[model samples]
Target: MSERTRYEANVCVLLHRAGRWLLAVRSPGVAYAPGQVGLIGGHVEPVVGPDVFETTARREVAEETGLDLAGVDLHYLSSELYLGDAGQPVLTVTYMGELADGIEPRVAAPDELSAVGWWSLAELSTVENCAPWVPPLIADAERLLRRR
Candidate 1:
């Protein structure tokens, strides 16, 4: 057999409540993009039962921020392929979710994130160290949200 490449599959979640984005600021200790404002998500776990992307989005949100997304509606925004720090091919899928009326987000994983809060795009623009890809994701999410 010929050689084949292996890629890591990851999922990212963007949550919005009344046109405000639920954003996370990564801690300075992370291996990738530390101290940046980015979406909340992680690698997809190997599970048999639920949708892997959705499951990962939910799990990551719960782990990174003390927020349960069980009741929120999740919409797939986009998928991207990029090179990781280790020169591995990485496939990242992004999901957009709308936060429930009364639900709130908190920084649950101190080691992974420094802060978690809701902000408007205008407000988010002023945040330092925001990820470069974050604006594109937000645009995609807003476009999708308008279709709903």
Candidate 2:
């Protein structure tokens, strides 16, 4: 018998403001990436409704950060594959957007996140215990920023 390959579609938002990006610390109790810093995102819930990747990105950001992206212009950043906590393959679509002036993120989902804050590229690179993909994502984000 062969093992079945499982896959999941997820969307993440790299919320930027004043040269900083918003990041969330996953709660220890969470199933994926527990206690690691990562972008605001989650698996697309097809049961609730079918949505475009951008809508899923926006929804996940709001659900995790309490920040409204109603008027914000989100740009497609990049996409990559990684293993989930359960070791299932995950395809993640990433979007970048600038938050409204003076807006900040809070822990909207305590059960999912332990903390939320803004981090600069340097900080992101040097920070210990960040999600393994985060450093490379930061580089991608920097390239995207340079293109703008």
RMSD, each candidate, Å?
1.3, 2.8
Which ranges in model 1 have alpha carbons more than 4 Å from their true place?
A: none
Candidate 1 per-residue C-alpha lDDT over 1-148 given as tens digits, one digit per residue, 9 for 90 to 100: 9999988999998998898999898998988788999989999877788588888889999999988887788988899999998899999999887888788788999999999988787777788788878987798788877887
**What TM-score do all the candidates reach, one by one?**
0.93, 0.86
lDDT of each: 0.87, 0.85
Task: Report the Cα lDDT for residue 127, model 1.
Answer: 80
Question: Candidate 2, residue 131: CA error in Å?
Answer: 1.2
Worst 10 residues of 1 by lDDT: 119-128
lDDT of 2 by residue, 37-131 (tens): 99898878766555578888888888888877899999888988888677879998999888877787899999999999988888877888788
List residue ranges in candidate 2 displaced over 4 A. 1-6, 47-51, 83-87
